[model samples]
Target: MSQSATTTQNPRNPDRHQGLANGGTTFAGVLLAVTGLLSIFRGIMGIAKNDVFVATKDYVFRWDLTGWGWMHLILGLLVFLVGLALLKAAPAWARTAGVVLASLALIVNFLSLPWHPLWSLILVALYAFIIWALCTVKRGHT
Candidate 1:
């Protein structure tokens, strides 16, 4: 068989495409970890009733600060773990997990916009970058 046919036929061929370089993956991993850490800190602040966050009145998405705190804490932990995983020689599943977690983080930060407008906006942008980086990998590149 020709080289091309042989490579195509072998599912586990090393010549198979593996999307994204080590650098890109590493960047995404670092970003995820940092973002996750920030979220965790934000969660703790919210839970502790820190005066840093402004109280919003009459907002449609109004949720108890404590409730949001717990939400962020749990979600942040998950994201952080996923980020750690990505830092290693992550598998395909890790990439998918990273994308999912980043998207969730973006939503969570958006919901928190009223409390800390600038910080929330920054996080939203960061998460967007993480999502983009994770999703930019071509299919076939591991």
Candidate 2:
């Protein structure tokens, strides 16, 4: 058989073919999805107890807790959508957006740590993982 015939007949290797050329992107996408869900849950909780939570320990800031809750809700929704897109083979821009959003989440959670210290810490850590996963793609492999 000619080289062209073999190349066209079996272009891909079933055993080696993965969803993404680099596994880091897939892992990062999964992390973003999970974290987005968590953010949605947390935002709902925040909105549910906006007043009491805000009143506790004089944690009131310039913006209302409910407003913050809304911000988180919107951000979470966007992140979840982007993550789904990433899983569905979105373009490189989507992946880059994920990284930027995750970084923003990290900063937001960090600044809000005083309100819910433990949960904020958890989110910060998760965001750190996301950033790491997104940034640590295999060099020269993709």
Cα deviation of 47 in candidate 2 (Å)? 2.8
The positional error of residue 36 in candidate 1, measured at the CA in angstroms, is 0.8
Error of 2 at 49 (Å): 3.3
Model 2 residue 119 lDDT score: 79
Model 1: per-residue Cα lDDT at residue 134:
80
lDDT of each: 0.81, 0.74
Task: Tell me the tens digit of each residue's lDDT in model 2 across 1-142.
Answer: 9976775567494323333435757777887888888778777877888854543455555567787787788788878887887788787677788889999888878867777788789889988877766665545433
**Lowest summed lDDT over 10 consecutive residues: which window, candidate 1?**
14-23
Worst 10 residues of 2 by lDDT: 13-22
- In terms of lDDT, the best-performing candidate is 1
Q: Pick the TM-score winner.
A: 1
Poorly placed runs, candidate 1 (over 4 Å): 1-22
What TM-score against the true fold does each predicted structure earn? 0.80, 0.72
